[model samples]
Target: MPRRVFVHIGAPKTGSTYVQNVLFDNAERLEKAGILIPATFAAHDQAMTDLREVPWRDPEAYWTWDLLAEKAAAFRGDVILTSEGFGAASAEQAKRAVESLQPAEVHVVVAARDLWRTFPSMWQQSIRARGTWRFEDFLAAVEKGEFEGFWEHYTANRMFLRWGDLVPPAQRHLVTVPPPGVSHDLLWQRFAGVFGIPDGLCEMTEPTANPSLGAPEIELLRRVNAALGDRYPHRMPYQRVVQQHLVKAVLQKRANNVRFGVGLDRADWVMALAEEQINQLRAYDCHIVGDLDELRPAVMTDSHSPGELADRQLLDAAVETIVGMIGHADELRQMIPPGHSGVLARVRRGIRRRLG
Candidate 1:
C-alpha cells in the first residue's frame, strides 16, 4: 500500500499550538508507529521556522510544496505536515500547492469551530498579530462581509473553501471542535482518527491554553490601541513589547475584577451568523464530527464577582500578552545570524531579552 500523507492545515484558533507541540515532542514515538513528521534539520524548531519563511509568491512560491515532497519522499512512515497559516493561502497558491503535491494521496484535515466563538478568538489573534481595530468595528465589518478581502487574506475558513474548490470533497476532512462542554481528549481522538493514527498511540499530555478575549478585555484592548495608535502602530515590535509585556502583564497579575459579557443583542447576531454558516457548510457535504448546536450562545454570566472582574480581565490580558511574547521568542532568536558584529548581536540580543 502507498504511504499515506496527511496535511493538517489549520484554520487557526483551534488548539493548533497544542497539536503542533504534541507532534513535535513525540516525533520519535510517532515515527515508530509508522508516522513521520518531517524536519529538514535535526532541530525541531527549525522545521517551524522553515514553514514560516516558505514563500507563497512567484515562480519559486511552490517551494513549500517542493519541501513537502522532498521530506515525504525520504520518509518510509506515513507523512504528516501541519501549519495553521496554510489556511490563508490564495487561490494561485492553493493550485500550486495541489499540483506540487500531486501523486500523494493528500488528506487535508481542517479543525473548525462555531463562528460565534471563533470570531472573538480571531479578533484576539488579530490583535496579537498587531491588528488595530475595535471589536465593535470589526464586527460591523464582518456583518457587512466587507471583511471578505481581509478574511480571504487572513482567515483559515476562506483558504479551506478555496482548497476544497481545488480538491475532491472526499480528500478533505472537516473536524469540528466542539465547544467547552466536550472533553478535549475526545476532540483529539477525532483528529487522530482523521490522520490515521492508531488508538493509544498518542495521548494529550499538554495543558496549552489558547484563551480568547472576553468582551471587557477586548474593549480595553480597543481603547489601548485607539489611545496608542498615533504613538505606535500595533505592528511595531516596540509597541508589542509595551502592550503585550508591560501593560498586559501588570493587568494579568491582578485578577481582582475584569469580567466581560456579551449583551443579548450581540449574542443573537453571532448565533444567527453561526447558524447561517453551519447551514452553508452542510451544503458542501463536509464531514462535521460534532454537534453544531453546541455553538449556540448563552446569556452572559459573571464567573467572577463584580469587584473582581476588572482585575481578572487585566490579568487575563496580561497572561495573553505574555503568551504572545513567548510564541514569538523563537522566531526572534533565529533572526540574529551567528558571527554578526558584536554591536549588532548585542542589539538583537537586547531586543530578544526584553521579550521575556
Candidate 2:
C-alpha cells in the first residue's frame, strides 16, 4: 500500500501544543512506527505560501510545501502534517494542501473544544498577543462579527465547513475534548488512536505546557502592552518579553491554581452556538471520537471580570512580573560568555562549589 498522510489540522487552543510536543519529542519512536512528522516546524508557513492569499514571508516560505510533499512521496512511511493554523485555511487553500500531498491517502484530523470553554482561553491568547480589549469587549466584537479571525478560526461550524468543502466527510475526523473532571490525558489517547498508537505510547516531553492566564494576570499584560505602545512596536521584542517571558515564564507561574471561565451573559450565547456547531458536525459523515455531548458548555460559575480586578490584584500581578523578569535576567546572565563577565563566572563557580 502507498504511504498514508495524516494532516492534523488545528482549530487552536485545543491541546495542539501538547500533541505537537509529543510527536516531535518521540520522533524516533514514530519513525520506527512508520510515521514521519516533518522535521521543520514550518508546515503552516508553507501552507500559507501555497494558499497565496496571506502575505506571509519566510526565507524558506516559497518552497516549503513542495519540499514537504516531495519528501513524503520519497519516504516509505506515513507523513503527518500538523499545525492549528491550517484548520483555518480556505477551501481553495485546503485543496492545494491536499494536492501537494498527493499519491498518499490523505486524512484530516481536527481537535476541537466546546465553544464556551475555548473563548476565554482564546481571549487570553489575544491579550498575550498585545490586545487591549477586555473580555466583555472581546465578546461584543465577536457577536458583532468585527474580528475576522474570531469566527474564521475559533468557530468550529465555520472552520469545518471550509476544510470539509474538499475533503470527504469520511476522511474528516473530529476529536472533541472531553469535558472537565475527566482524565486530562484523554485527548492524547483520542489523538494517538488516529495512527493506531496504543494509549501511553507517547509521553509528555515538557514538564509544563502553555498554561492559561487568570483574568487579572491577562489584564496586567494588556495594560503593560498599552503602556509600551509604539515604543516596542516590533513583533520580535513584544513576543520575546511579553509573550515568552511575561506570559509564559512569569504569569503562568502566578496564574496557576486560578481558573477563569466565560461569564453568564457570554455563557448562554456560547452554549447555544456550541450546540449549533455540534448539530452541524453531527450532520457531517465524519468520524468523531469522544462524546458529542461533551461539546455542551458546562455551567461556569467562577467567572472573573477584567474590569473588576482589585487594585491589589493588579499590584500583585505587577510584582510577580518584576520578580519573573529578574529571574529571566539571571538566566540570561548565565548565557553570557564567561570572558565577558568575570562576576558571573565567579558566581557560577561559587554555585558549582556549593552544589559539590
Candidate 3:
C-alpha cells in the first residue's frame, strides 16, 4: 500500500497548470525516487467531473472516480493526484474519496492566490468555457451567490474548511502563490515541498503556461460567445476548436499591450472579505508554505473596463481573431489523415467557409 497520498486540490488561477506540467514533465525522475504520478490525469479529471455531477462530454466520467481511487490505494509508493475540480468537492464527496483510498495517509494541498487577482482570471476562464456573461455581469453574479463555483473553489477559507472535515489539520496544506512580478519558480518550489520533492530534481524547460487574455481580448470573446449562443452548444466541439485551438494555440500568442484589473472603488467589499477570510485561515490549524500576506490582493491604481475599449483596440482584436482563426483552420487541416476521411472533412470545411 502507498505510504502517503498527496492530493493537490486546485483553487484555479493559482498556477495549477504550471505545477501539473512540471509534475508531468518529471514523472520518470519522480517515479525513480519512489513517487508515482499516474501516466494520465484524464482519469482524475473525469472522476472530479463525476463527483461534481457537472455536465461534460464523457460518459465514462461516472465511474473514473472509483477507478482512480482504486489505482491510488493499490500503489506501493507515494502518490500525487492533482485536479482543480477537487476544489469543488462537497463534504459527501470528500468523505467518499477518503473512504475509497483507505490505509494510505491522505494529505490535501490547496494552492491559492488573492481573490482579486483570481477573480478576473476566473471570469476570463469562464468565457473560454463557453460562458456568455460580460465582466460586470459576471461580478454581479458572483456577489449574488449565483456563481457558487467562485466561492466553492476560489475562496481559500471555504476550501480548507470543507476538506478539513475529511482530513486532520496536520494533513491539510496551503501553498500561497507568490505576488505577481515575482518568479513563478518560487510557486513551483512550494508545491514540490508538499511531496518531499528535493530541489533541482524537476526541471521546467517547456512553455506550458495557459496565458490569460487582456481586457479587450476577453471582451471580444464574450461578444463572440453571445453571438454564437446555442449554435455550438456541445462542450467537446467548443473545447477543441474554440478553447484549445483558437484561444490557447493562437490568441494567447498575440501581442496585446493592455492589462485587466479591478478598481479599488469596486473592490472595497471584496478586499475586506478577503482580509477577514485570511485572518480566519491563520487561526486554522494547517501547514502553510508561503507568506500569508501574499494572499492579499494589491490594489490597482487604474482599472480598465472592457466596456470602454478604444476603436483601435477593437479593430486590432478583430483582425487578430480573424488571422488566428484562419491559422488554426490550416493547422487543423494538416492534422487530418490523407484519405477518404480527409477529403470529406475538407469538403465540409470548404462548404462552411463558403457559406460564411
Candidate 4:
C-alpha cells in the first residue's frame, strides 16, 4: 500500500511544541512502528511556510515545499508532518503543498483552541518574537483586522477556516483542544485516533511550559521589545532568542507575578467572536473530534498574584530556556560559520557561567 501521509497543520498554540518535540525526540521509535517523521531541522518551519504567504525575508519563510517534498519522498512508512503556522497560507500555497505531495493520501489534521485563550497566547508569542505592541493595542489591531494582509497574521477564526479551503472536507480532521480542566492527554488521544494509532501506545509526555505573559509580563515585554525593535525586527531568529528567552524569562520569574490572560471584559468580547466562528465552522460540516462546549470560554482567574520575585528566580528560568535552546543555537551557528557566536548563544553561555 502507498504510505498514508498525515499532516498536522497547526492552527497555533495547541500544544504543537509538545507534539513536534515528541516526534523529533522519538523519530526512530515511531519509524519502527510504521510512522515516519522526516528528519529536518526545518520540518516545523517548512510546514508552516508552505501554508502561508509571508515575506521571503521572514525567518519562517525559509520553509519550502520543495524541501518538504524531498523529505516526504524518502519516508519508508506512514508519513507525519506538522506545523501550526501553516494555518496562515493562501489557497494557492495550500494547493501547491497538496500538489507537491501528489498521489499520496494526504490527511490534514488541525488542532484548534478557543480564541479567548488563543488570542492572548498568540499576542504574547508575537511579542516574544520581537513584536512591540501593547496587549490592549494588539487586541485592537486584531479587532480592526489590521494584520489580515500577511499570511499567518493573527485572525481568530479566519485562518482556521482556510484549512477547509485548502483541502477536501473528507480529508480534513479538525481536533478541538479541550478546556483547561480536561486532561492534557485528551489532545494526544484524539490525535492518535485520527492517525489510527491504538490508544495508550504513545505515552503522553510533559509539554514544555511555554509561559504566557500575564499583564505585567506583557507590559514588560512591550517595553523590552520597544527598546530593541529598531535594532532587531521580528523576522530575525536572533531577536527571538534574545526577547523570548533572555528578557521575558527575567520578567516572568519576578516575585508576585500575575498569570497571562485577557482581562474579563476583553476575554468576553473575543470569546463571543470565537463562538460565532465555531458555529460557522460547524455549519461547514467539519469533522470535529471533540465537544464544542468544551471549547467555550470561561471566566479568567488569576493563577498567580502580581508580586516581586528574587532576582535569582528570574535568572534561573531565563537560564533554563537559554540552555534548552543552545542546541538550536549551535545548529544556527554552524549554518553561519562566519557569523559571531551571536547574541543568543552568548547570552546562554553567559547565563550558564553566572549560574555555575
Residue-pair clashes per candidate: 16, 0, 0, 11
Superposition TM-score, candidate 1 onto the true structure: 0.71
Q: All candidates' TM-scores?
A: 0.71, 0.85, 0.89, 0.76
Q: How many clashing pairs does model 4 include?
A: 11
Candidate 1: worst-modelled 10 consecutive residues by lDDT: 299-308
lDDT measured at residue 303 in model 3 versus the true structure, 0 to 100:
76
The CA lDDT at 286 in model 2 is 84
Between prediction 1 and prediction 4, which has the larger TM-score? 4
- Model 2 / residue 50 / CA error / Å: 6.6
lDDT of 1 by residue, 3-58 (tens): 66777767777776776776777778888988888763223233333444443222
lDDT tens digits, residues 1-356, model 3?
89999988888888888888888889899989888887577767877787666766465344467777777877798999888878888878877877777678899999778878877888888889888887777777877869876788777777877786578888999999888798878888899888899898988755465667877788888888888868767666788667876678777887756877666666786777678878988998999999888878775455766767888988888898888889888887788777656687689899999999
Candidate 4 matches the true fold with a TM-score of 0.76
Instruction: Evaluate model 2: give its TM-score.
Output: 0.85
Q: Which stretches of candidate 4 lie over 4 Å from their true place?
A: 50-53, 56-63, 145-157, 237-241, 301-356
lDDT of 4 by residue, 69-176 (tens): 777877766888787766667767767776777578877787777777776678777777677766666666767868654225343255545555656777778788
lDDT of 4: 0.65
**Per-model RMSD to reference:** 7.5, 6.3, 3.4, 7.7
Better TM-score candidate (2, 3):
3
